[model samples]
Target: MVGVKANTAAKFRLYPTADQAERLVSWSHTCRAVWNIALAQRVWAYGSAQRKTLQAGEQCSELTLARKEHVWLRDLPAQCAQQVLRQLDAAYENFWNPEHPARSPQYKRKSHQQGVTFPGQAVQIRKVSRRMAHVRLPKLGWVRFRLSRPIEGTVRNATIKRDGLGWHVAFGVHRPEPVDRHVNAGPAAGVDVGIACSVFVSTENEGRQRPDTLTAGEKQRLRGLERRMARQLTFAKKHNGGKYSKRLRRTIAQIAVLKARQARRRADWNHKLTDDLAKSHGIVAVEDLKVSNMLRSAKGTVAQPGTNVKQKAGLNRSIADQGWFEIRRQLGYKTRRYGGELVAVAPHGTSQTCARCGTRDSENRQGCGRLFACVHCGHTEHADRNAAINILDRALSTAGRAGCAASGRGTAQSTRSPHGQGSLAGSRMREPSSNVTAA
Candidate 1:
């Protein structure tokens, strides 16, 4: 028996008519209500051992009874509403599983419940033209969307999600990744992600640097807009019933626009960069950086306030703008599809560790310096570039181990997918890992 590979997703912008948009919004509200109601029911059930383990099917039956009493519940699509209960059940399972570090189920706020999933079998997509397509929902009928890319594989499921800009549809499909052994067939290289430059790539011949996502002018505008939005928020809170002023609303919209633009630019850059790397490298290595942990707020409680909170906040913003995690993720899938392999190496001492010599010392590097002057080996190199070199060596070593393991020799195996999504089953990715236990 042959096992099927996992499906990947592609997102596209949706353009619904005014009437369709209003209907979609109403559906979302109903879905949110259902999620909140189901969550409350579960929370209340925990009080009595008799009903503590209420199943999703039981809640779904209850929903059907409620719909009979209130036909308004039946106004929306049945399957979409039922998916809320399914999601709630999954949430509970995740919370209870010790291995899965997922948060317990919480009530969904209207602001956050902005997406709905539709089973692919229940919907149909038709390509209208080269740059146009239409998808049909249960009640919403046919909705138009910009077809930026062709739908290549069989669609498994589709989700409609509203972002800062507008609505988008993401389709999950199992498309075979085209492999080319000739692309990036050269020796493995290393990539270092940092603040000064988003990516510093080192090859056998030379190293290259990719600049930060935002320009100087854009950074200044972002700071100014953020400051303005803060002021607006404060002013809005002073009004009756905390009603936001027009200025506040306008400021928020403006901020959203800027953020959307930033997101687009960053996505574009990452896609191009990853594609190039996958097309060119036989093997690549990158640092396993915990972007979320690294960007955590430094400000603590009033009793024990954190030091350099403001400085840390700024650094967090800069690091987030780089989208290190996204790069790693894109690289994961791209490298695998493009006939290359990607491995992650620990980033602990890559910068300070002399690339030329096996030396690891904190004092080998100095403050706010890009030039790495190793004290022990008397080696000089760009800090990020040197780090890339070290990463490449580690990646090569990992690949060699995997190769040996395949031949029944090495003790360890590498299991990480080039797509960076961890396991096809969707597991949390950790760093300082050699990806032992190859798939």
Candidate 2:
């Protein structure tokens, strides 16, 4: 919000020809080769000197080291091999002395590795050929992409990544401003996220409804594929060591494809949901749910008070599928994109805390089916909606923004300001805390 800075991220799936695809695979191989070579050198150093860690200068030099064993670097162009080894060194260093003491860097396998980047220089596009790239690797040809989005500012290299369903190239750019900062300030809203209806709002239209984008049809297809996969099984030979048959392997691959497609669908749903909220609302309020704690708690599992173990497992699986982390990530970026504020309210006591008189002790309303009622002030509301409203109130109050709550009885209390100045914009009523009661 202070320093006006802009950046661009563009991703496009490459429709490479068969030859191009094979070339890309070879490029991947080259990257792996360079990394493995560097790794081998580091291992040898550690073994020879019996040292735990080696410094940058102490490590093998690019020229002298590559000449003796890694001759591939000499004939296959210097930049490619140099960048790969540089990345390998960085990876090894990071793992050896990770920022967190508890986290230890594990070995990286070459089979899964896909890319390498040069800070600001790899795959540079010339002025005349600004939109295309010439991949000058072993057998890779010139790969081109339609300039879907114009690239502004310095091209900070490119990364060719293998995705779940396809291959993609991402271009990171330092771009010019698209919209003014002042154009982004708007009304705030509280969001109650759920599986049934992704997000329920309590601002702007007061109670406007937005349906969950995860289609039922997509879910049915996923279930069907899973069932089909479960029905197919293979047993290894008792004497000779042998895995599943080729036909079975193909079946497993098909299941993997289906699962990946479902994941992509879910990701797209969350992105669109977060984008809409950020574009429309200036301030977004959400609870900082301890999802891990929830999963471990009694409410997270056990349908009917400890009955139906199978049902509880199904419930847990569905909860994990909802993609809570993805939602949070999208919201963070979306808020920044719109120049809006996103407040993650503390989720503790939000559900039981009464919005009317701020009383939080037992006697307000017993947790029955799915509703909340305050005994002291006699305020009643839908359980989830009430929690969301309370979260909204706390978020706005913390930021010095204005808000007020309505009572259950027909009468209204006078509006009070945080600094005793005036009521919030269109606030109906508010009251100071009084007698406390939980149920």
Mind giving the per-residue lDDT tens digits that candidate 2 earns over 366-424? 85444678877888876567666777887777764532111101111111212111101
Candidate 1 is scored at a TM of: 0.82
The clash tally of candidate 1 reads: 10
- Model 2 segments beyond 4 Å from truth? 1-7, 26-119, 125-139, 176-180, 204-233, 236-245, 290-316, 361-370, 402-439
What C-alpha lDDT values do all the predictions have? 0.72, 0.54
Q: 183-211, model 1: which lDDT tens digit per residue?
A: 44455668888877567888633444455
Q: Residue 16 of candidate 1: its Cα lDDT?
A: 92
**Looking at model 2, how many pairs of residues clash?**
10
Q: Which ten residues in a row have the lowest lDDT in candidate 2?
A: 405-414
Residue 239 in candidate 2 has what lDDT?
29
